[model samples]
Target: MGILANTVSFRQYQVLGDPPAGDPGEWAGPLLAKNAFVPIDSGSEEISSGWVCLDDPQNGSFAERRDFFRPPSLAFTLRRDQRRVPAALLRRHLQKAEEEFLAAHPGLHRVPKDKREELRDTVKGALLARTLPTPSFFDAVWDLERGLLTFTGTSPNIAEIFEGLFRQTFEGLRLVVLHPFARARALLPAKLQPLLEEQNRAATDAVLEQIQENTWLGADFLHWLLAHSVAGRNSFRVRRAGPALMDEAFVAFLDNRLVLAAGPQRVTVAGPQDHYSEARIALDAGKEIAEAGIFMEKGEDAWKTTLKAETFLFGSFKAPGVKPEKDGITDEKSEREAIFYERMHVLAEGLQLFDSLLLAFLEERLAADWPKRREQLQRLLGFEEQ
Candidate 1:
């Protein structure tokens, strides 16, 4: 899903290096053009991946700044085209070829392994040539000001591909996933940062290590949210900087679905959780929240999303739609630009609200009396100390 969509599922990364000194366009514009997606229709290449215009995946031209640059951000789509030959079809063709080859060799009862391998490759290539390459596009928006990148997909394989392609294209910059701990660090005030660091169990800065060591951050946050949701304590104030006003009141809570896990045991409770009885049972069984659907509301606006605990990835995040008034006087391009900015504005507001909620959790979590509070939560959820 694209960022402009009413609902978008994305994972964010922090860009870890600086660009060249001067107009960013001087470097980025040319680089984007150089790494633009190339169609594989004329060739037998199995796959191709490169950047394309965000608005038009088919248009790889990056001749103007407006193509990708939207002031403080650069938006583009990563296009991957791949051709796959059906295994059955390839096997059938290879078998036919092997039989013909063996029939031509009067003494041979079976095709040689080398000859069979060669025939298979030939058949596969022929099939690929005849097949049209299926194209897939993943949108990305780079917040140049904050050095963050929002990618519109959550698959690990695709993330790896994106990181590699981004490094290959930009040369100096690298992407680091904004995992739970990293995000917490970013959200913390200077005085409380040391407290967060003390809790970091990872000996190294590796992403997997950080997540594995800091599972408590996500687990506890969800547990806290679930506890509060059931207790009707869903109100919070904005404490992070973004599109929303400072200290603005908002309501956020877990709802619709909740995924809990303990070791290999996993359970999913769905539907409007009036009592969250199933979740409480799972908690009693030593399961913690691995993911849950989150809903946030401020006045008339609302946002809904599934929050992945381990990686903090937001799935199916539905922000309030941008309904531009019909001023029939505006051109299509101008209207598109307006919609893009408005969408980005709302998206930022949604993220701010989420981060504020996390900050609220952290404030309580890192407090001196968290152990006491945690125990209270346990008692409320009917969890026996193990």
Candidate 2:
């Protein structure tokens, strides 16, 4: 099954190796069960079987692990469960009961610490036995032919567990997290390679500084683009090394909605009608973009995705204009291989566009330019200066 937009966030991995021989329908279940989680009956933490078919073939039955083979790809759900007793609540109840016991037996002195600890354990055990487990679900798709696996998840812990489980389930397959650094390392030009490689050699926050530098550029570029779009200016030009000129395309329009968060708790979201003004208000109120649904056409293909500003992560990418073709393909394997590589190439291009736009923003605009531009945006949107 393919990743569905709106609900899940995902990261792509370059799966390495040919598809395992034998019918996936027959061996998939055995592989999944090999590393499946076992739920403890009465423990504070219990992890359930994390691997299962995404769509249950049988109604209310897990025998549907056989349904994982959906032609060229295998899709499944990774789930984990955690059960815990609230320590504070249990302790509070134990303390109240201890006080009652002391009051009843006024002849006895203070209860021994060891006996009190015993009571505490009893209370904790009772609570643990009664509490229900919290469950987490993630979607995973394994493209058998192209050696590409896309995990529909975002959390690092879940990702770690997923990687371990995946390796255990399918021996020799390793998942390299395609984080920004990893992507940059894989795709950045040779000249800038040293900057990334030597970033962490000296422990002066260089690696983090590099990341922040890029992140700031990305945010400022988005901010600058929004300002220019509001003012009806879209074209941009970049000066490359020597006399060469590089065409810069960072045009993006706010799509359906914008999501902004002031801090950890407050989020102000608005839809398309007067969305720019809503965004200005949120910005003026000291909010950072949590997610911005944007439509961007930088070069060959237009991209529609929700951009998470904090991490510069794109989600639910819609690349309709760039479709892979299998024009001369005769066999199913060849066709699948062509489509997979094409999709990967398009994704790589999108990432390259992202890097180029941020570089352009940093080079073409200075830090001193932001305040004036920000004021102009606020004034245009009719928001009072803070």
As for candidate 2, its clashing pairs are none
Please identify model 1 stretches exceeding 4 Å from their true place.
324-326
Q: What is the lDDT of residue 337 in candidate 2?
A: 45
Estimated TM-score for each candidate: 0.97, 0.56
Regions of model 2 farther than 4 Å from truth: 1-6, 13-29, 40-49, 57-66, 84-89, 96-117, 144-148, 167-174, 184-213, 224-252, 256-291, 296-305, 314-386
Query: Which candidate has the highest TM-score of all?
Result: 1
How does candidate 1 score on lDDT?
0.90
Model 2, residue 132: distance off in Å is: 3.4
Highest-scoring model, lDDT: 1
What's the CA error at residue 146 for candidate 2, in Å? 5.2
Full-model lDDT for every candidate: 0.90, 0.59
Error of 1 at 280 (Å): 0.5
